[model samples]
Target: MSLTQRSSGLVQRKTATVQSVGADGGVEERDDEGYTPDEEEDHDSKETRLTLMEEILLLGLKDREGYTSFWNDCISSGLRGCILIELALRGRLELEKAGMRRRSLLNRKVLLKSSNPTGDVLLDETLKHIKETEPPETVQSWIEYLSGETWNPHKQKYQLRNVRERLAKNLVEKGLCTSEKQNFLLFDMATRPLTDGGIKQKLFEKVQESVLSRWTNNPQKMDKRMLSLIYLAHASDVLENAFAPLSYDDYEVAMKRVQELLGLEFDAESLKEGANELMWAVIAAFSK
Candidate 1:
């Protein structure tokens, strides 16, 4: 089947059932369509256009709560890693040859060859940061610096400020999430909830299928973008969120498959390739 047909089927299957208390204190069943007309239109526009950063943020976000899970502390850094990978894929950044001594990523350096605007605000800012730093730093150091993991707490400044909020706003712009204010009796909190369940469901299925079936035996055959998602999601500890509905045995198998991928090491020849370098760099960041 075509992707559109498959997505439509998934959306139809995911239509939510609403239950309400009737006047007689009994429950009444109400069938509600999952998305509004505008939302449906938006979904068609955004169905296949999500960026790696956007996908990661979506996976990390809680559906109704409109925020990320507490256990996903690594997401900030993971997203930064995603930025690096994206840039590398676009030929904006590369590892310095002289620094690749096979010792450690800490000793290696990431050089910015082109500052040509990526038209992405976050990516452009990250590129500018890399270009402006006096002495170049290694991929590992840059990941931690962008993640806000640093000494001299007062001077550290690479946290990708307002990362969650910015990404949430971006999702809102894409019509995947709705910005709503909720009252907690004392103050109001602004939250972004998944208003387009179809899109999110599709993403979840993609990740689950890749990890559980498609790439389990041969991860090298997975799409580069999907591979990046798996590594980043696992690094952020949000892979469980994607597999939450699976049976115990399925989940266990998926975890084992992921461990297998994580355990695989890249040889020197593979690391010389641009794509492999970025992939290994991300893996190395999370491995630590």
Candidate 2:
């Protein structure tokens, strides 16, 4: 299945590659099947796409409550991890080379491959922070920095504020959710509840398909984005939300398969050509 098809609900976008960063700092699209001048226009006519961060957030959110578990502290870090992988997949971010000494994944620094805007506010904001930072940060550091969990005052500046709220707003804008004011006794805060169950159901179907019908035991063979989603959702401690509705037999089988994926060697996968080392690094960071 195509990348957009796997994640898409109402509309699907054709496969395209980012061949260059235009002078204006936006990505220049080149279709994988070769350039079709109208292809760009065609792709844009489709509905807005959800980023990996949004998908995972949607998975975690309660359809009616419009909020995740109060005790799920891991999600903050997990969402940060998703942002990094999302940026990498969009051809906007990457990891520094291993170099002659062959450095470890965590030891390598995160670099901006292109300053091209992702068109998502949260992504654009994070990209700007990465572009402005003097010394590059490692994947682990970036996660902590973006999560605002770092102790260093200067590093704390890199945090992406209101991440959950922002992602929810993005969903709201796309018509998948609706924002409402919810009171919590002390204060009333904005909450985004799922509006379009059709799209959200599509997300559930894609995730289930990944581990069931489309199960590729080898991480190398799996779609990088989907593979990352499974790991990231698990890391966020919200993966069970997706599988919770499964039958007893399917749930057991699906979880068993995911555990197998988690046990694979990250270092080895990172070495493969075209592999997103930054993604592996995020998985590794979360593992610890």
Whole-model Cα lDDT per candidate? 0.67, 0.77
Residue 201 alpha-carbon offset, candidate 2, angstroms: 1.2
Model 1 reaches what TM-score against the true structure?
A: 0.77
Q: lDDT of candidate 1 vs native?
A: 0.67
TM-score of each: 0.77, 0.86
Instruction: For residues 1-288, write the lDDT of model 2, one tens digit per residue.
Output: 001112335233445554766668976666442333332222233555567788888888888989887888878888999999888876688889999998888899999888977567888899999999878989998988999989999898898888998888888888888989899999998888888887777767777777888888778877777788888988888777777667889787788888887787888889987577888988888775
Best by TM-score: 2
- Winning candidate number (lDDT): 2
Question: How many clashing pairs does model 2 include?
Answer: 0
